[model samples]
Target: MATGLILIFDKTHFSKYFVVPSTLGALLALAIPDLEGGAHDDIIYNGLNPNAVNNSKKYGINWGYDSHLFWEFLITHFLSLVLPFFLQIIQPKEEKITIKVLWKSIYLTFSVALFLFFFSWIIYAIVEKHGSPAQQISWNANWFYMGHKGISTLGELTKWPYNIISLTIIFFVLFWLVFVIKIYFEIYSFNLSYQNRKIRFFYIKRLKKTVFKENVIKSKH
Candidate 1:
């Protein structure tokens, strides 16, 4: 089984595309609000002649109890904390993915995440306390405003625990964004180097083609 797995990894482009994208995509999906409940409610209540209150109730999905949201929270936070270091490991040694670099990336990611989360709370508090639509609009224009609104609304409607979880989600998203920026720069550097050296470009092109061909072979096998 290990041999088969090794062959599969060696013979597929999974690492090139699936690894990074799937990891990042899962993280992003986890970060976003569970529109799944909304979707399910829409499907279930696909009828006419409902009253306003009933319609509202029908439209609402009990996100508070949804297992998926809990999973998303766990997955997102785990990925945000661990994926940067994981990425560093996967990168070529020549790429200089050092402990220092990994630490810096983690620090930046966590810092940004914390800043956005707290900032969101501050905005939420101000908007809710002020009780002015105009003020809310102004606050919404700010960068961390979404966190504020989400946290405030959830807190007002639900209990403290839920509100705290919501804030944690915001932090996860912020950290994920930082990781994305780091990956972008890494990819950009590779592309720049490839552009400058014909030999490098040749190797990259060959690598991609070989990987694709290997994937096809593996799929057939």
Candidate 2:
């Protein structure tokens, strides 16, 4: 998803117009979920290990609520905000948006999302079967960990709402794929039209010059 936006906006002439909006759109997609209440409550309410040896280790601090919120902010929004800009500026500008580029982006996003989903499910299963420390670990790790696994577990145990959200994200990706295809076709058509126009104009100019030279030769003869 991040790569796709970068390629679409960064590699194209449209970058001047689309880059900021595409970046903001990606950030908005990631951030909106965190604003609402969900599984993060456990970490937010309880806090991190203060007295533990790990907490006392160098660079260790009991993050508690702040830590939880920080992680939530990072995963849910910050990473998304950072990634598009990073890709936009860092990647080689010469990269072209071929079909390979488009499909690769789609595949990468789906693969990452699916892996996160299943990884969360496994964590939830462990927490459900074993309990507590594991659950705590799962909750505290990162927003992606919680959002993917915790919400999935919640949906399974409760009813249908959680599942619906998961499914909706998947479908949204599908919709994005359609949009990507449309953009590719539009770019392709525009390029082809421009090339054809240039070629025709070149031929027309050459033909006019040839005819003018022929008339000059005839007049001299």
lDDT of 2 by residue, 1-221 (tens): 44446456744432322333344445445544433333334333456453443523323134334667547645645554565455545543433333344445445545654566666666656665677753545443333322333443334732222533554464457545644654444333322235644743222123444444432343343
Off by over 4 Å in 2: 1-31, 35-76, 89-92, 133-221
| Per-prediction TM-score to the true structure, in the order listed | 0.32, 0.42
Candidate 2 lands at a TM-score of 0.42
How badly does each model clash, as a count of residue pairs? 0, 0
Cα RMSD for candidates in order: 17.0, 15.5
- What is the Cα-based lDDT of residue 99 in candidate 1? 30
Q: Residue 194: error of model 2 in Å?
A: 26
Model 2 global lDDT (CA atoms, 0 to 1): 0.44
Cα error, residue 59 of model 2, in Å, equals 29
How does residue 212 of candidate 2 score in lDDT?
40
For candidate 1, list the clashing residue pairs, or say none: none
